[model samples]
Target chain A: MSEDKNDSFLSRLKAAERRSGLKTEDDTKESADDKDGQSLATLALRAGTEMISALIVGVCIGWGLDKWLHTRAIFLIIFALLGGGAGVLNVWRLVKPPPV
Target chain B: MAGGSSIDVLGQFELHSVFGGLGDALHFSQSPVYMMLAVVLVLAFLYFGMRPAAVVPGRFQAAAEVCYEFIRNMAIDTIGPEGASFFPFIFTLFFFILAGNYLGLLPFSYTFTSHIAVTFALAMMVFVLTVVVSLKVQGIRFFAHFMPAGASLALAPLLIPIEILSFLSRPVSLSIRLFANMVAGHVMFEIFASFVIMLAGFGVVGDVFAIGPIAINVALVALELLVGVLQAYVFAILTCIYLREAVAH
Candidate 1:
């Protein structure tokens, strides 16, 4: 009885393996085609998010400094411009392909 | 289409206490409840799936192994040979976000990742780890990363702050990407679902028209599923990339 149970378990495992193997092979082929489309979408999203975030950070830093140093709009204006520049730089770096 | 009420799309993200008394007293909201649920589900999957350790492996076991191998390979591929040490961290991070995303797809479940707080915390952890690793590996030289190798001296005043701002924004960008994606997808789902309800109120013809929104919702769900996995993959891969930069000479 125990041996029979073991044999059944082994057969079930084999079946599972075969099923998964077939699924994975098909998945790899489909994903290869899908990768290009997906990466482009991801890149666009990444670029936009990075640029906005960098600008926000720069502005925040500038505003905080202006408040602390009791400067009027001097630091704020400078930092906002710097922040925008940083944001553009971030987008550029993000879209550029990595160095080989 | 006539006199339809405005849909409260953002209302779905409002926080409310779960488990009644206990949750109220502790100020514990649905977000943490779903986060804990995600953690438990991940643990259960790993435990139950690995329980049957057969040579050929059963379906559950195979799934568990595949998850393990996927993260393992990703770490190595992105972070190089040293990636082995960080596999467990990346694995946990990937599955946690994935579970949160998938769980949110259920009828009434809250998506913890939709909250910027949670994603920011996760991103901050990654940022802190990268900083620590860079400092540990490069020591004082880590500061040199603020300035490019061949930059002119005159540009230092302009470039250093820009570089620093970009560096500081990593966590912000990382958190916003996931949070925005989750929020946008969920809001779209809500808007479409509300359309189905609103259209159904118009009678038989309206009910027939409701099919349009329903069909769009079905497609949206499918797209959201793809987005969930893709976001998780992106997060993990980005973490690996950061780690790779940290450890590199």
Candidate 2:
């Protein structure tokens, strides 16, 4: 009985292995190489947060610098723009098309 | 939720002392209690599950081995050969978060992962570890990554700040993602549960209508289960990705 169970388990494992191999084989080489289980919804969720967090950090730094320097809004203005750029850069990195 | 018409969805997240007056005196809350429980649970699982150490393996051993192999393969595959060195850290992190998430699904359990403070602390640790690893592996050259390979020298003033800001955002985004996902799932669960309670208050017809929300809540629980595991997987994979970049030098 135990032998039968082991044989069944082994066969099921082999079947699973074959299925996964086929799934990976069907993907493009680049995706297969770097695939880390990110689905579309996950990427979407990540991209939104990536952009916003960078902007938040940039604005915080800018605001702190302005306070330290006793400047009105010079540093704030500059850093906000920089932060916005950083946010775009982050989103770009996340959603950019895979390499050819 | 005691009062009619007040949803009180967010109240589920409130942290209060447990274990009677001792907890109040110590300022200890359910958060730490749950965290300790998660830690003990993970430890007990591995210890008891693997105590037999049979060659053929029992059902409990198989479960333990599957968890081990999943994290082991993920770390090695994502971070290359150097991943072996970081496997223990990654394994602990994955299992801890996984445990906390799964534990939260149980009625009356608090989820530490849902707290911004807890998630931020975890993310900051990962961020600091990656930075340390990069500095150790690549030395002075680690700073070079802030500037892209082909950027003009004149553009450094603009580009460097953006790059630095982008890097600084990593921990913030990582923390927010996990916290937000956990909080959102739990809040939705509570809101739907509230609907069932609220609807049943209206009488027999209301009781029949209340079944709708109950059905939805059941579905939401299933969704929450998937989200809990998926969020844990995302956190682990992102950690591996960051470590890969750090160790790539």
Candidate 3:
């Protein structure tokens, strides 16, 4: 029912992939996808959509809490900052340079 | 204590509280504790699941093996055979998150993954780990990943910066994807649950109608369980895709 037809040890890449459990395709290896290299900024911008939403939500929640507690925006500022920091952090994690 | 997003993302069964609480801080900040609980859960699962490695294999072992194999297949299929080495890491990540997720589904427990800090921290670890691996494997050549195969010198000026920008955006997508999904699922669970609880004590009509929320909650809990695994898988697998680019590039 199942088999290990393709098995090889490449090195760091292999280790990372295996750990992530994110298999793409085999056969030709990682070749087939040479479409005009997609720009890194494009993906980053796409991800920005999520970041922006998080920021708005964090800020609104914090602000609403401030309103509830009558404590101004103390939590709002912190949450907002955290939200922004998270946005930048996401960029740091995913985007990568193109292959040579 | 469970607030924010709630759909009972994991088939949130109402868990009996295992430990007494410390204070409001401990009660509100349930991430670390839940994570600790999840770790113990995994240990228990492995202990019971693998102690009797039989020829025929017991249901537990069979089930555990299936979990491992599924991820194994995912890694091999996504990352390749070299991915076998990552089996431990993937398994750990999968179980840890899975446990954390289910733990939150427990009644009155804080869902750590629902918190951005926790999710971001986890995502950041993966990001940093991948970078370290790439640099170690490729050496100085790793920087060359910035350049595309055949862009003209003129185009490089514009395209290269764009490439760099996207490269930097990984963590944003990675972290938010997990955090958002978890939070969203949980929120749905909460809203539906509140509906059930509020409507449950109204006598005959309320009692008869209570089944609606119960049924919905049950279904939601089941769906959330699937989502918990799905999110974990997506997070781990995306790491593989990004790693491929890092290593080969």
Query: Quick one: best lDDT, which candidate?
Result: 1
Q: For model 2, what is the error of residue B185's alpha carbon versus the real structure, in angstroms, after optimal superposition?
A: 0.6
lDDT of 1 by residue, A51-95 (tens): 999888888988999999999888989888888888888898887
* Better by DockQ, candidate 2 or 1: 2
The window of 10 residues in a row where model 3 chain A has the poorest summed lDDT is A33-42
Poorest 10 consecutive residues by lDDT, candidate 1 chain A: A17-26
What are the lDDT scores of the predictions, listed in order?
Answer: 0.92, 0.91, 0.69
Compared with the true structure, what per-residue lDDT tens digits does model 1 show for residues B39-89? 999999999999978899999999999999999999999999999999999
CAPRI quality of model 2: medium
Listed models, DockQ each: 0.63, 0.70, 0.05
| Per-residue lDDT over B15-95 for candidate 2, one digit per residue giving the tens place of the 0 to 100 score | 999889999999899999999999999999999999999999999999999999999999999999999999999999988
Query: What's the C-alpha lDDT at position A51 in model 3?
Result: 63
Q: What is the interface RMSD of each candidate, in Å?
A: 0.7, 0.6, 8.3
In Å, residue B88's CA in model 1 sits off its true spot by: 1.0
The digit string of per-residue lDDT tens for model 2 on A1-100 reads: 9999999999898789777775344466658545555476678888899988988888899899999999988888888888889989999998888999
